[model samples]
Structure formats: C-alpha cells, structure tokens
Target chain A: MQLSAGARREGSPWTGVWAVFLKEVADHLSSTRMRILEVLILLSAVGAVYAGARTLQQTVSEDPFLLLQVFTAAQDPLPSFVAFLSFFLPLAAIALGFDAINSEYNRNTLSRVLAQPIYRDALLWGKFLAGLATLALILLALFLLVVGLSLIFLGVPPNTEEVARALLFLLATLAYAGVWLGIALLFSVLFRSAATSALAAIAVWLFFALFWGIIAQLLAQAVSPYDPFRPESELRQAEALVAFSRVSPNTLYAEAIQVLLNPAVRSLGPVLITQLQGALLGSPLPLGQSLLLAWPQLTGLIALTLLLFALTYVLFQRREVRA
Target chain B: MVIETQGLSKRYGKVVAVEDLNLRIEAGEVYGLLGPNGSGKTTTILMMLGLTEPSGGTVRVLGLDPVREPLSLKKQVGYLPDSVGFYSEMTAWENLAYIARLNGLPRAEAEARIARVLERMGLAEVAHRPVSAFSRGMRQRLGLAEVLLKEPKVVILDEPTLGLDPEAAQAFLQMIQGLKAEGITVLLSSHLLHQVQAICDRVGLFHKGRLVLEGRVEELAQRVLGGAYRIRLGASPLEGLQARLQALPEVSRVSLEDGEVRLEATQDVRPLVARTVLEAGAALHSLALEKPSLDEVYARYFQEVRHAA
Candidate 1:
C-alpha cells in the first residue's frame, strides 16, 4: 500500500480454496481405510468380469435364449466383461463416495479447512472432483483389465465399433456413479455422522437397485393386472411396466447397457423372452441401433447426477462453518 | 476499522454462547482477548474470522467487513485454534509446503520460508517426521510454523501456550514479541491472566460473552485496582514504633507483629514511611511497591470468584 492518502491497496486471490482442496485430497489418500475401500472395489470389478466371462461361455454353447446379432461383437453379450461389472460396480462407486463429505464433517476437519481463505463452493467441488478422480481411475483400471481378460479368453480384441460402444458404456456408468456421488455428498453435508450418511446412502441404493423394482412390480400387479400375455393387452401392460422400470436410475442404466449389448432384446419388459419371441411375434432394432435409441436414458441419468451435484453446492454454501 | 464489534452476539439454540459483545481493537497493537472456558473467546474468534455469522451486531476486521469480505479478510490473516490439528500423515515439511502452496506462495520462496519457519520454531530436527508422531509440544510448534510461513499481517492464536512447557511458552512469547517488532498486529488470546499479561500491549477481558473490560495492562490495573504499597519494618525493638507509624495520615491500616510492621498504604508515602520509622529510632528494612493483580481485577468482573476474597 502507498503511504499517501487516497492510494489504492493491492488485491489478493482466494488461495484458500486451493489450500483446502489439497488438504482434503491428502486426508483421503493418507488413510488406510481409503486403501481398503479401493482394493474392495477393484476386487468386485474383477469378480464381475470373471462371472460375465463364464456366463458368456455357457450361453454361447447352448445358444442360451437363442439370441442373435448382426455384428460379430454383438453375437455374444457386448462388453463381454462389463456385463459382469454392471452387477456390482455401483457398490464400489458407492463405497468410495458415500461418506466423502459427511465423514469430513464428522471428523471436524471441514470447519478447519474452510477456516482458511476457502469458500464453501470450492470445498464441496474440490472433494467431488478429487473423489470422482479417484473413482474414475479405479473404474478405468478395471475397464482395461476386463478388456485384457476378454481378449485372452475370446482370442479376439474388440473392433473399432465394439471399442466405441464399450467406451460409451463405461462413460455412462461413470455418469451414473457421479449422480450417486453427488447424492451421497448432499446427504453427507446434511448429516453430521459418517455412519449415518453411509447407511442412508446404502439404504437408498438398495431401494433403487433391488427393492424398488420388487415394490413396483407388486404395486403394478395390484393396480392393473391386465394380463400382458394376451396379444390384445400385451403392448399396454409391457409399456406400463417398462415405463415404471425407467423411473429407477439403476433400471435405466441396466436397460441401456443390456439393449446396447444384445440386439435381440427388443424391449426390456416382463422378461428376457423377446429373442425367442421372434419365432412368435417381432423384434426391434439391432444392438447398435438400440443403444442409440437408449441415448435419452443415458442423457437423463447424466443430467440427474449433475443436478444433484449443483444442489449439493447450494446447500454447502448456505451451511455455516463453526467447527 | 482494523477490528470492531458492536453488540455482537451468538447463540447455539438454548445456550447463549456469546451475548451483546461490543469491542474495538485498533491497528498495530497486540490485543489480548482473555476469557475462561465457555466465556466466548473462541466464539468471538470464529466470528472475526468469518467462519460463523454473528447473531447480533456488526464486526469489521482489517477495514473489510468480516461477513461481507470474508474471502478478502481471510487472505490477510492467520489463525491458530486451541486444538491445532494438521495433516497427520504428512511430514512437517510436506504439511507446511502444502499450506504455503494453498496460500499461493511462489515455489522457491514457499520452500525457503517453510525451512526458515521450521528452523525458527525449532522443528528442524523433526521436519521430516510425519506429524502423526509429533508430541503435543512439537505439534504446537508445527502449527505456529505454518502460520509464520506466510508472514501474515495479523496473527491470531488461541491458547497458544496450552500444550507448551515453560521454556517453549517463553520462546513462543519471544517470537510474538519479534512479530511486534515488525509492527504486525497480533491477537494473543488466553484465559490465563499471566499469559496475556506477559506480552500483550493491551488486553480485553471477556466474561459471559461480553467484553467487560479492556485497556492497556498497566492502565486497567491502576484504574480497577487503585494503588497499593507494601511496607515492612525491621529491627523494631524501639518503643512505640507501631503506634507512631499508624499515627500518620497516609496509612489506611497498620498491623504490628514481632519486630516488624506491615502497612497497606492508601497512597504513595514511602518517604514519610521511611522518615517515621527512622525518626522513631528503627531501621526501615524492606519496602516493595506492587502492580495491581490482574487476577484480582478480573475476578471482580466475573463476580463469581468470591469478590477477590
């Protein structure tokens, strides 16, 4: 500052945000629990790839479901290994993210971090970005490992089109995890305890991934049992159930990936009887075309995740850091 | 205002953490905010740092409104909480380097400054050790090292001597006196009277969330404590010496004992005292003037310490 009157003082940037971000990343990576969680997630991803490979072999021998496809890659389940991953990958993603924000608050570090030159938005976004980075690295490693295994077992590497489709699947699943990460952080900021946040997030996951479908099925049956087996009512009941399933992000991701992989799955309705149903009625688009058709579902999932993340930012800004 | 507060209050639901506090601490002076447990010392610090909003009036620090300019104000300040914690898994060098990075210290300078501060705080021996293994005193030193790494314009520390042994605490005070020599303002907060009394240029007394008293240590003592002088007589085998001393106007009270006299004077009358004892044919053995006890003055404000007993 100049000594004379009316002289202007120099300004400073908010380096506090960067400081807090580095501190948080350090804290998370420094813990043994982080390593344990990392190993657990990768082990599950590897386990899924193994299971998917086994399933692909059995299906190929018996022509299970008599599924057929136009492209050679689509002749069997696409992503040959990702089919296994989709089953348990959310657990890995959830474990990494469920308590990211809440646990910091629980440990009383959030207040200390923000007491620096940092703003609330930076703290929330920094943690999200760091966590998402960690999650992505794990997922990418598993993706590469799955591809290696598929090449080893099937004796053929994926073609360009197959590779593009597989990358899209991976991206879609990441977006799915991003949405849940945002949701988890929101809950974390809302709750003061890591245990509470983890429990609440896992409970929500159970509801969407498994229990929600069962409850919806029971509700749909009680509401209108219009016997979709009858050709007259087949379209309406199938449409109702499929629309209901799409309400779940898990359902959307699963259906989008399944349709992308299997050309014979014309509709993800009451059952996987559609490939065989070609002998009886009809089929929809080929696998690639079906993937393109499911683009909106993928977009919706990504949009929802981004929206949840934005809400978390707003709530974090409103919170007072007194710790 | 370098720092100002008017009727600022804070409450945690049913508990009023701080209520109706009004204080003004000016620039270029070491201000001590002294209070006991739950007296709202930390609450006031949090508000001043913009970590928590005040429930009542306004507060301004460094000529920027704390709430309105938190981002700017924080950049100009360094704070050390009572329970100082750091990235425990990182080495001291790594910890200080990371904080310096966050503060946008230029690369070469940040490393150099970290080294300087680590050496200054006497942490050079264990600079490479992870803070997880740091002793309590070592951790406190590391915390001070982090704040000093940036050379902030205003350094705020709460109970800085809490975990330090006498040698370390004395060294800490000397370091703060060095900051004062640089003309940087500091807020040295502690509940202990002697801690603040030792180094602070001025002290603010906090009781029940309000700043009940504030001034320079000597000035407040004189105003609140009045003046006192202790006079002890020796070799007083001379006859009628106690009665002769009590006969003086300056003496408010007098006590007599074996070969000595204790006088609590209402005014400075050392000359009269010496003359009276000598004229009475007794030697004046010892006389010591004392500063007013902050402990006594502070207890009067709390009114809970039995009114100075």
Candidate 2:
C-alpha cells in the first residue's frame, strides 16, 4: 500500500483544504469559548428581541412593517437586535479566528501540516473559510430565532418584499462578520502569542465600533469645519464626516443594513427637498432600489474583507515555517 | 537516485544558511545528515522539502523537482519535523485521520490505515485519548506513525530523537531500520554522532553550511584518521613493548593511554605488535583494531575547515 500514486489525485486539489475545514469546524463547534460566546450572543439577542416585542405591541396597528421593526425597535431600556448584533458579531468573529494561525505555530503543528501533500494556500484558505462558515451558522441560527420570536409577537407574516430585504440584510451581516474574521486571522498570523492576537483583534473592534465614529467626526471637523453664517459650509462638513466614517467597516455595515432593513431610507447622505420633489411622500422604495442604495457599502465591506485575507496570505506564504 | 541536489544554496540577506550543497541518496538507503546546531542541517532538509526556497541551484525528490511541483513530491514523501506537533485537543486517532483525509484517502481506507499505524506504533490502546496527555516518547512514536501511514517512497526525519530518552531513542533507531527494510529511502538529520553512526548507511558531515566529510562510517574513519590499532597490556610498565612496537616498520605512530597502546599503522600490524609484546614479556590482555569514532572524525574535519577558512 505505497502512497506514491494514492497521493497524486489530480481531481481534487482541495482535499487538504476540505479536510482542514472540517477539522477546524469541529474544533470551533466543540470549543468551550465558542459555546460561551454562542450563549452570550443568543441570550443578548433574545433579550433585545423580547424588549423590542414589548415595545412593538403598542405600535403594531400603526406600523405596516411590524416584522421589520422587530430588528430595529429599541425601547428606552434595551437596544435593538441589529444593535446587539453589530456590537456582538465582531466578538464572535474575533473569538473564532484570533488563534487560527498562531496556535498552530505555537503547537508546532504548522510545519507538520504543511509537510503533507498540501499547498500553504489551501491550509490558510481552509481555516479562513471554516471560520466564515462557523460565523454563518451562528448568524443563521440567531436570525431564525429573532424571526421566530418576532412572528409570535406580531402574529403577522412578513411580505415577500420584506423577507427579501431581511435576507439581504442577513447576507450583509455575514459579509460584515467576514471582514472582522479576516482581520482577526491577519493578527493571528502577525503575532506569535494567541493572547496578543486576541487582544489586538478586540482592540481593533472596540476602536471601530465605539471610538472610530467620534474620532472620524473630530477629524472631519478639523478637515471641514462648519461656518454657521455660510450654510454651504454645513454641507461640506457633513460630506467630510461621511467620507471619514466610510473608512470604518462598522459605518459601512451599519449603513448597508439600514438601507436593506428600512426601505424608507432613500439615501445614506443628507438629501435636499429638490431631490425628493417628485417622489412619493410616505411610500417605501422597492426592494431593488433599496439594494441598489446599499450596493456601494456592501462592496466596501467585501473589499475590506478580501484585502485583509490577501495581506494574510502574502505574509503566510513569505514566512519561514521553521526558523 | 531517490534524492538529488545540485549546488543548492540558501541565503538570508547576507548570511548564508546553506552554500553550494551537492548531495545524492540512492534508493532504499538510510542517509544521515550530521551537524551541530546552526550547521545548516534543518535548512538543507527544508530546502529539499521545498518548504524553504533555495537562493540558487536545484533539488529533486523521487525524480520530481520539489520547487516546481512540491505538492507532487510531497505526495510521495513523508517528513517528521523536529518536535512534531499535532492538534492537542484532538485524539491521536483524530489527528492521524485528519492527515489521512488530507492525503486524499477514502474514509474506509483512512480508518483502516489509522488503525494499522496506531497498532504498529503501540498507541492503539490510547488512540482515543487526547494527544496532550501523551509523553515525549509517545509523541515521537506518533510522529513516526504519521510518516509511515502513507508508506511514502522517501521519508525525511529532522532530528527524530532530539528529546527522547535512551530507550526511546533506541526504539526510534530501530523504527528507522524498519523503514529501510520496507524499501523506504530515509534521509535523517541529527547532531548526535552515535545516533547517526548507528543507523546511517552513509553520512554527510555538515559544518558551517558546507558538507566537509561524507562516506560510510568505516571509510570516513579510515580517511580521516588512517588505519589504527589499540592493544591493552597488563604489565606494570609497558616501556619496552611500546619501544619494540614503534620500532616496527609497519607502525607509523604510537601513543599510550590508561595501560593501552594505540598504534597507527600502514598495514595489519596487530600480529607484529602481539609477537613483540610476548617476546618482551609484557602481558597482552586484548588486541583490537581502532577506528576513529564519528565524533573524532567530525571534530578533525571541522578543525581543518576552520583552519582553512
């Protein structure tokens, strides 16, 4: 049973990638950290949905898109499900990926795994894809739970257009999560200590999610300050702020989700009365128009994700596995 | 040749890790790459595996260029890196199964191979246990199991017994012998002279990024130190016997240490030495030919290289 011919299987070059993907999937699913993160996110999602449901009961009759409101509804005491996800999904992505590369290096398994009949591209790709797959699964489950809870509360099925918009929003969220996962993987490849990579990933997330908006606003202010006497300066100031905010993946994701989930939102930027002169006053945009509005933001998020992965792949390939 | 390298070199900036290495290993032969730490043994192995690209020259494993088609060569070759690591969270069976699946083995064949490899490595009983609980020896054994599971045509082991105890090291050497018996060409690198001497059919003594000496063990000894003999005497004073043996035309040099006279000779002079010793009334307890141990040859070779440099 020599392996000379058994190994040169020409058909499936991705066997190693698939094998690594399955192994990583199992590791992530069975890990205590994953379980804890899952519980944390699940509890937070349920808490937010319950609060949203309580607040939606009073306005269910007035709101035609009651099901869509379940995602964005927030009472004085609780945040919305989308808000919770925007804050917590990054944690899940980072948690799943912070040690993806460094742990293998620390354990001395990277060399052995590379010694097998697999390319480095496959190994790294498998790990990244597996992390994304896990993120997808968790997001899918949370979305289903949110929908299930919202259905019981509203007692009304969502329209086909609403469902399509929500599904697009879900996909946008996955792309958002993928961006963070790629960043975490890049840090993992950069740092030798898993703790360092984890901390770095969390720090980046905190900066983008919490501090980046304020910093971007300040920088925009410095770049284009408002002169109250000159009303045109206000437009320039707002444009500067919007341009700076787009640098953060958080802003891009939030804007895309807002457009997808709320068809009433026509533009992410400030709009003038002249632009809305011929439009219906209170009608929502069609699903296609909503997607078109969010396309740029979605493309930005996807490009960020790919850029991170490309950097990681280059670093991993150039690195000496044993030194 | 199962393995070949032509003027292979690796340089990191200005520092040369391996320089102009020309090596060849025949099929079914056990070749040892012996060197001290930082002597380029690991670098050479990495170059051969195409894990590290050479700055210049070429390498072929099993008639395939490793750099052009590393995956192809890797398919027919197995490597056990120094301090071989597996996923600690997974069981031994799980780790091996993962590797099997990576090699494109079907599920049933993978399971069967895993069982056979684990049984052969004496880890079948603990196959279900997590690898974190395994001892150093057990991990080394597991590393061997990984390398052999595929039955590769060529096996490369980098410091296979670095941390093993005496018994484990012996067991590892025996397993390397077993690989040769199975018609597997093995290229193992080690800094330990005795370990390489015991298992290697031919050895290349690497020094300062260059192979300074290479040949069979006895042939290397003869080339470096010449034909020699050691005769132990029981007499209180061996002055007369030493004089008589040194006076013989066949003897070139003589030295005494711990009541034993070491003789450097151009021919078989044991019989002449024994006759002289008996004639001079010196008690002759044992007579044996002396071959320079691999360490002595290595030291001498390196010293010569240093002086030349």
Candidate 3:
C-alpha cells in the first residue's frame, strides 16, 4: 500500500508504444522514400489498369461496360481480375516493405530511439504496424482509383458475387503483403546493412516468385521416369510438385489468388508433368477449395516471417550501442 | 549525494574498459571526471547512466538503480553523450520535439518546452534548419538544449566541450555555472585538466578505470603542495632564521632548489614561517606559494599506471 517517492519515478504506466509508432512512421514518411513509394505504386496501379482498359477498348468496344461484358462472357470476371492482380499486388507489397526494419538499424537510429522508456516489443510492433498502415493506406488509395474508375466507366454496380470475389482478392493481397513485410523485417533484423538487407529480401522474393516453380518442375521430372504424361500418374506427379512449389510464399500466393479470383476455375489441372500439357489436365479447383488447400502454406510463410523477426529482436537486444 | 558508485567496473571480454571505482557526487556540485583517451572516463559515465553494465560494481543515481530502473532514472537525468548526433534530416525543433515526446512530454507541452530551450540556448535562429547544416559547436548546443528541455534533475555530459571553439567553450562553461545556480547536478568528463579546474567544484582523476585521486580541486592540490615551504630571508643573518625554524622541530629537511630556501615541513608551517620571516627582517617581496595543479596530480597517477604496465 506504500510506495517511496523514488520508486514512483521508475515505471510509467505508459509503455511508450504510440510514441515509438508515430516516430517510426515519421522517420520514413517525412523523407522522399514515402513519397517515392506512393508515387511508384499509384502510378503503376493506375497505369496498368488504364492500360488494360485501353486494350479492352481497342479489342472489344470503347464502352467500358461492353468490355466488362465481353470479359465476363468469355470467362468469370473473378479469375480475370485474379490473373491481373496476382502480379501487380505482389510488386506493390514488396515495394512497400522491402526495407522497413533494416534501414533503421543500419542508420544507427534504432538503439537511440529504443533507449527511450519504450519496451522492445513496442518498438518491434510499432515498426510492423507502421509498415502495415502505410501499405494499407497505399492500397486504399489504389482500390478507390481502380474501383472508382471501373464503376464510372462501366456504369454498373458490381454484382454481389463479383464484390465478394473482389473482397477475397483484397484479403489475399493484404496477406501477401504481410508475408513480404515479415520477410523484410526479418531480413532487416538479420542483416546489418540496408543494401544487404534489401538484396537478401529481394533474392528470397525472386526465388519464391519465379525460380521455385521451375526448380520444383525440374526436380519432379528428374524423379519421375515413367511417361509423366499418363493421365492419372501425371496428375499424381504434378500435385506432388505443386505441393513442393507452394512452399515458396510467392508461388502459393500467386496460385491461391488465381483460384480465388477465378470463380470459373474447377481445378488447377492434373499436376503438370514432362510436356507441360498434362499440367493442364485436372479441372481447376473452386476458389474456396483452393484457399483451404493453401492455408497451411500461407500460414507457414507468415510464421517464418515472425520467427525471423523474433530472432532479430533477440539479436537487436544483444547488440551493444558502440556508436 | 546525488550520484554514488561502489567499486564499479566494466569489462568487455578481455578488455577491462573500467575497473573497481568509487565515486560520490553531491547535488549542485559540478563534478569533473578527468582522464585522457581510453582511460575509461566515458565508460564510467555510461555505466552511471545505466547505458553500460559494470562488471563488478554498483552504481546508484538519484537513489535509483540505473540498470534495473533505467527508464525512471533516465527520466530525471539527462545525458549528452560524446559525439551525440541527432537525426540530420530533421530540423533542430523536430529533433528536440521527437526526443521530448519520447520522454513522454505531450505534443503541446513538448513544443513549448522545445521552443523555450531553443530560445534560451540561442538555437532559435536556426531552430527550423535541418541539423545536417549545423556546425559542430551548434550541434553540441542543440544537443544540450535537447537535454535541458526535459528539466532533468541531473545532467551528465561526456566531453561536452571537446569539439567546441574557445568562445563556445567559454560560453558553455558559463552555461554550466548557470545550471549550478538552478541546483542542477552536473557531471562532465574532460581530458583537459584546466577546463575542470575552472568549472568543477570537485574533480576525480581516473586512470585505467580506477579513480586514482578525487577531492575539491584545491584540496588535492594543497595536500600535495603542503609538503614543502619556501622561507625567504633578505638582509638579516640567516643563522637566527635557520636555527629558529630548524630548532622548532617541524621542518624535516631544509635545502635550496634555486637559491631559495625550501623547507620539507612535517606539518603546514605557514604561521611559523610567516612569523619567522617577519621577525627575521626579510623583505617578503612575495611569499610565492606553489601548489600541485589537478594536471600535476593526475600526471603522477598516470605515471603509476605507466610504471605498473
């Protein structure tokens, strides 16, 4: 019931979380980095969508609704949107996160800020939240532009199913960003230099996005001596390789988004083999089923990011502020 | 005492940066930690600030455990590290406001406090300018301004004047005295002995992580200089003066260093010598007194470290 005057000064009920959050945001937001990121993402999203609209205008009709009708008539709009966004959103997410944590530590400013009466968890959480918030803000602006322009030109409110599909796409995109942000933060924590951190993060991103699929295919082909083109056998072999390829976050997100956005898809095909024709044999899986199948892979990617971040926190705490 | 330590030592693997040291600093006292490079003065200060851990000692600041209670302890204490730099891209105002907010000053209060400190420290002219443009001295001033914005109970500076111009250093010393007027406990470390001599109420000379000597600067000097006294007798026969001084039994040895009588007095023979000089009819052109300077006292200790090495 009694406290000394001295003890009163030792612990503030404020964990100093918000202060660190605002400061971390301020560190990047004030500089040209934030502006550069915003400009690059907005321009690319707007430009790509505008380019798609232009291409549709030339091929189908000048009327945007006519273009939408043609796309929906050919195949479900969900799959088409999924195909379009899978490539764009990952780029945006990677751009937003790639250096969030590493740059601060590289600049020798992290320790100075942490030395203030803030918990390490707050600092880590604050940085993560700030990066996520910035990404969300950028995404929101892009969403408004894309949806707004589409609505104005098409002159039709998106149907319930289409809206639901769009929402799923949004969720998957955000999750994909989470995966990148985690890896970036992890790399940031693991590496000492901003450039090195960026290089390592980009290398991991590229490996997952482009190279892993090819590597898994080659590995699958080398292991399968039978005519991998035989329908059922080819299907089994393709699924095994697909499972292996899904281990990389990029491939999993890309494929999952494709499935979620394409309402028409029944399956991803009988796992492709040898000639790559067998890969297209299986019917495309439905959006829901694809997501269910990819849940473990998605979670594993996110967990890996968190694990890297936790390791970084430990290392950061162990570091001596010699400078 | 505002700050006290008991045998504080810090080891970085094989390197003993600081070793068994005892220090006491009182409130409103300008305590100077004097040492050359790598003498562990900075290491000691960092330990006191709870920034570094002592390998085998305890440090208490403002009656709080610095290590276990750093946040609470730091809130009441301000530290200006040697070569402390701010966010170069931020204006001085922004940098100060950032640190103030970190210290839990609300936005409005932080702005007001930052403005007042900047004005008081004469940093207002360039307050809005990015810190990257600030000169070394201006940056130092801004650093101190940031600390003062918190209104800390104790201020600890490491080499605060090391990179300042002579004029700036003079002004800075005056500023420190003003801090004393406000009852702020100031602990500053310096390699320059004269700087400590001018501003410090008490000085501690550290070498190899240990405090070799500490006292009110004048007292330490007096203790060393008290061993010898000069007796000057002008016209009269030296026999009476010499016999009287020697027979009094306080003088241990009498010799002339440079044609001036030097007495190795067993005790302070000031009164006896004064009376002897007057009665002996010696014209006291000047009873020139000599005392060991803080530098001289430190030199002897430094020699010990050298010899031991």
Candidate 4:
C-alpha cells in the first residue's frame, strides 16, 4: 500500500457532540432514578397549586397576579410550588450528573469512546447539555401543570405581565438547576468512584441549602460587629450578611425567584427609610423593573454554572482515559 | 509502514512507563506486542492512538501523526482496549450504532455497517439483546465488531484474548487471521505467547518498558535458543550416546536424561542419528524432533536477560 500523509483535516471539535447528547438524553429520560424524581416533583407541584388556588378562591380580593400566587402562596402543611421546586430541583440535577463521567470510567467505556474520531470537548459538552436539556424538559412540564391547575381552580386567565414574569421565573429556575448540574459534573470528573462523586455533589448542595445561611450569618457578625449605640451598625451588619450569603448559589436562586415571581419584592437588601420615600407602597413594580432588580442574581447563577463547567472541562481533558 | 514510532518515551513522575522506544509495523502484517503486564505495551498503543500523549518523541499511523492529526488517524485506525466495555443497558446494535455515529457515518450507512459488522462477529442473532446478558467471549467479539464498524485500515487490540477460554481464544485468533487476510495491519498486545504465535507475522518482546527483542518467531528462537530444533532420541544402550550426539556436526548440544538422549540441533539430523543407532546395534524405541515453541523461546530469552542483569 503506497500511502502518503494526507493534508491536515480541520474537523470540528463538535463533530460527535449531537450523537452523545442524544444518547445521554435517552438514558437520563429512561432511567428509573429520573422517574422517581419526576413523580416526586409532580406530586408536590399538584399539591402546592391546589392549596394556593383554594386559598385564593376563598379570599374575595382584587389581586392582579393571582396566577403567580399559586407558585408562592404557602398553605398550612404544603409549601408553595416555588418552594418545592427550590428544594427538589438541585437533587434532580445532581442525580442526572453525579455519575456522568465516572460511570463511563467504571464501565471501562471512556477509552473506547475517546478512541473514536472526536475530541474530548464533544463528550463533555454533550453530557452537560443533555443534562441541562433534561432538567428544562421536566421543569417546563411542571410549570405548565401548575398553570393549568391554577386556571381551573381560580377561574382566571393569567394577564400578559403575569405570563411574562412566569416565563422569566422558569428561566431563572433552569439556571438554578444548571448550577447544581455543573457541580455534579465537576465532582463526577474529579472522583473516580460514582459513589464518591454523588456524595461530594450532595455535600455541596447541603452546605449551600441548609448550612450556608448560618455560616454566612456568623461570618457577617464577625466582620461587622453590631453596636446598640450606633444604629448605623445594624444596617452595616445586614449589608455584610447579604454579601456573605450571596456567594451561595442557593441564595442567588432564591433572590432571583423572589424578584421574578413576586413583583412586590422591592429590593433584596436593606432599604433605608429615605429611599422608600415617594414610592408606591402597595403597587407591584413593572415587569422591567422586576427583571432589572433580579438581573444581578440571574447573572450570578449563570456565571456559577459556566465557571463550574469550565473547571470540569479542563480537568476531564487533562485526565487519562485509562481506567 | 502503517505505524511508526521513533524515540518514544513516557514517564509518570518518577516512574518511567516506556523509555526510548522505536517501533515500526508494515501494512498487511499482524504484529504481536508480547510483554507481561505493566511492560508498557498498552501505553505504547495509547500513544499511537493519541489516547495518551508520549512524554518524548513522535508516532505516525497511516502516514498521519497521531498527536497532530488524531481525528484523521483515528478514523482509519480502530483500537479495542483491554477488558473493553459498553453501556450494558444498550443492545449490541445500539452500542455499535453509537460508535458508527461517532465516526460520523450517516444514519442509513451507520445502520448498514452495524448490521454487517454484527453479522460478521456472529452477533446477528442477539443484535437487540442488552450487552449485560452477554458472556465474556461474546463481549470480546462485540468489541471486535465495534472496531470493524469503522472498516479501519489498521486495528490495534490490547490483550484481546486475556480472559478467554482455550476454545474461545482459538476462535478469536482465527478472527485475527481473517483480519490479516483482508490486508488489515494488526497490532495486538498480549502476554500469552502460544495463542498469538499462530497469527502474528512478527513480534516485539517488551521488558521493563523497553523493547528487548523484535523479530520473526523462528528467528528469535534461533537467536535465543542457539538452535531452532530439539531432537529427542530414545535408544537402547544409551551409553556413549551423549558424547556421540554432541560430536555430530549439526548438533549444538546433547544431554542424557531419563534413559533418553536429547540433542539441540541447528537442523533436522534424524536420518543421521537413526543410521548411527542402527550401526551401533541399539534399538531405537522412539525418535522425535521438536520444533522450537515460543513459550520455550520466551523463557530462555528472559533467562539469558536475567543472567546478564
């Protein structure tokens, strides 16, 4: 065989990304773990929407954004739809991604897959995108279910502003889920064992979800000591607390949802008495103002997701394919 | 050459995995890389596939640099790793289809090639059965089927027959011979000498991250054993038989054990030995000539290397 060196071919690094993405998405959707999480999220969403709509129907009041309230209004035992989502969305995202890369290593498939004519970039991106797409599909279904239930119970069609705010809320929720997915993927790449990666992802989630608030409070107090004699110290300490807590993705998601879902949420930080002067006390802010208020939080969630994914990409590329 | 490497080396921190290696394999030949585990055969294969970067030197496969033009190199080269794995939940066809897609085969073409390769590997009967239910031999065949899906010009198999039973290992060797018959350049790494000896055209022996020996099997046996044949003579009146056989022109050495005369000869001296036995009035019970076995060649070469060290 007379063979000469062919000219260097510049095939795109994304050559096989779509194939990987399709396979991963199929695996995630068909998995039993995802089915269980889907059932849990669906039940909570139905229960929360039922309770919130019941409450709204009893109250003979003129609330323009009654549809939005179905997501935020809490009953005696059941938290609102948004609350349920905030609690379970991270778990769902982590479940989809915790074993993404490590399972390939465990099964001894990484080397075989890498041996194909594709860059490592394609595999990592494909897995991450598939995870994000799965989360989006589930969240979208849940949102529509809540909306349909609210319309039936409250006998009210959501206004344009309500629909817009709800859409933004959904986007923020997806970004929130993306952050946890990124965390799970990063752990999956860092640890060789699937159990270890899952544990590490859950540890991160628990820190931000349950322990971060207390830790942030303590840190703020230590940084800005409160003094009874100086009233301004109280405001300074509150500012410090907000700054410290915002580092957690959970805090960012919560703040973003507050502004997006609750148009009456004027600010996320301490408000001075003078700053509230001449403001319409009871009126809801316009959709634009609400989005502007939540812009920093929304961007923070996206940045955290990107940063985590970038770190995972670098680590996975540098890693050896051998098990 | 289909695959060539010059001054190739790999070091993992303080430990040298492969050091200053030069290897060349021609097209349409089955080249066996023989080594015990951790002798750098797998690492060298990885470097050639661009799956692992070499710490020094260069590799070219099918006239393309594995590092600089990996996609092009990989498209023409198929690598079946040791203990190869697939998504067990997926069917045999699904697993192969995924590999075909990664090679950027069109949907119809991918399906066709998958069907063809599965049939070729004798997996057509269970094409839709999940791989988890497959036995070890079946999985190894499926691994080969995956490699053949690309219709590669060169195929590299690492420890392809490691855990197979004797019957299955023999069957796998026949498949490798089939590949060679189709003019595919094959590089297979294995520690099992006799099994691969039937299929490999040439072999390189690896020891402690170095290519200690490389040549045809018979040539290696000649160089290491100092002769290629062992002739055993069973004769009555074994007295003076050892010195007599030792003095023969064709024989290199002679020994007497268990009332039998054993002689290492450069060629077949059976006729001469028989004539001498009859003239001496010795009854020749059984006389046999043994071709040099690779197992013996490997053992003797290592023994010599050990003694030298």
The chain B TM-scores of all candidates, as shown, are: 0.85, 0.93, 0.80, 0.95
**After superposing candidate 2, which stretches have Cα over 4 Å from the reference?**
A1-15, B228-235, B238-245, B256-261, B266-271, B274-291, B306-309
Give per-residue CA lDDT, model 3, range A1-323, as digits (tens). Answer: 24666545345434676776787677657757678767765665555455555555556433323322322222323234334455555555555456655555554455455546555566677777777777677666766676777566555576655565566666666777777777777776666677787777778767876788899888777766347457576666777787677677677676655565554344454523455554444444444675675566566656755776677677756655554
Order the candidate numbers by lDDT, best to worst.
Answer: 4, 2, 1, 3
Evaluating just chain A, the predictions reach TM-scores of: 0.75, 0.93, 0.74, 0.96
The DockQ figures for the candidates are: 0.35, 0.52, 0.33, 0.69
In the range B17-86, model 4's lDDT, one tens digit per residue, is 9999999999999999998899999999999998888899888898888777889889989999998999
Query: Chain B alone, model 3: TM-score?
Result: 0.80
* Alpha-carbon lDDT, every model: 0.71, 0.87, 0.70, 0.91
Please give the range of 10 consecutive residues that has the lowest summed lDDT in model 2 chain B: B228-237
Model 1 TM-score on chain A: 0.75
Q: lDDT at A2 for candidate 3?
A: 48
Models 1 onward score TM values of 0.80, 0.94, 0.77, 0.96
Q: Ten-residue segment with the worst summed lDDT in candidate 1 chain B?
A: B226-235
Model 4 regions lying over 4 Å from their true place = A1-9, B235-240, B255-261, B275-283
Q: Residue B289 CA error for candidate 3 (Å)?
A: 6.1
Candidate 4, residue A192: CA error in Å? 1.4
Share of reference contacts kept by candidate 3 = 0.28
What TM-score quantifies how close candidate 3 is to the native fold?
0.77
Q: What is the clash count for each candidate, in the order shown? A: 0, 0, 13, 0
State residue A173's C-alpha deviation in candidate 2, in Å. Answer: 0.4
Q: Where is the poorest 10-residue window by lDDT in model 2 chain A?
A: A6-15
Report the error of model 3 at residue B270, Å. Answer: 13
**Candidate 2: lDDT of A161?**
83
Which one is best on TM-score? 4
